[model samples]
Target: MTVKTTLSFTDRHHRFLTDKVGQGVFASQSAAVAAALEQMIRDEEERELTLGAMADEIRARLDTPRADYVPGENAFATARARLQAAREA
Candidate 1:
């Protein structure tokens, strides 16, 4: 189903869409706008998925026992030593 609606764009945006259509990147201005909207929808969906995964990771870390957690200083020291070794090699 196709719905007809009026949309306003800044001069810059209009020029970009017009250029894309002229270059045959899209069939028309409407097609270019639709493709852009589709890309935006995909980006938003990907962002939501990444946020959810991060939240799950945070929850898992929080559930870990204190004894299993590494001290921040010790972790940083180990990382720095590893980095130094890698640089020397």
Candidate 2:
């Protein structure tokens, strides 16, 4: 089920879409708009999922005991040394 709606674009945006359609990038203006809207929906969904995962990770970390934590700098130093060794090899 698809909903039909009218959209107004700025002159610049209209020209950009027109040029894209002229170049055979899309079958029609509707196709170009539909493609862009689809991409936007996907991007927003991904952003939401990422934020949810980050929130879950933060909550899990907050529940962990501070005594079990290692200094971040120590981890970074270890990773940096590994990269240097890899480069030398």
Candidate 3:
């Protein structure tokens, strides 16, 4: 059998986890903590996707041309310079 270690949380969050366990959403503190971590990971992933989409919308508003899309350090200047250089090349 595998022995497990315990993790501690802040007072309010601890009370929240304890309440969830008490309410039978989870069998124990470990289960409740696992559920909380999973929820946090899910929320983080969603936030990342939302932020990415917002950035894409801003980029679209900038109306950057396809051939001018240079994904380099200092994006704005680089893309413009790259397109200009490519035109002369």
Best by lDDT: 1
**Once superposed on the true structure, which residue ranges of model 3 sit more than 4 Å away at CA?**
1-3, 64-89
1 or 3, greater by TM-score: 1
lDDT of 1 at 17: 92
Of 1 and 3, which scores higher on lDDT? 1
Query: TM-score per candidate, in order?
Result: 0.88, 0.82, 0.57
**Sorted by lDDT, highest first, which candidate order results?**
1, 2, 3
- Per-residue lDDT over 1-89 for candidate 1, one digit per residue giving the tens place of the 0 to 100 score: 99999999999999999999999999999999899899999999999999999999999999999999988888799779999999999
Q: Model 2, clash count?
A: 0
Give every collision pair in model 3.
none
Clashing pairs in 2: none
lDDT of each: 0.95, 0.94, 0.85
- Evaluated against the true structure, the overall lDDT of model 2 is 0.94
Model 3 per-residue lDDT tens digits across residues 2-88: 469877679998898889889988998888777777999999999999999999999896897777866666668867899999999
Model 2 alpha-carbon drift over 4 Å, by segment = 83-89
The clash tally of candidate 3 reads 0
Ordered from best to worst TM-score, the candidate numbers read 1, 2, 3
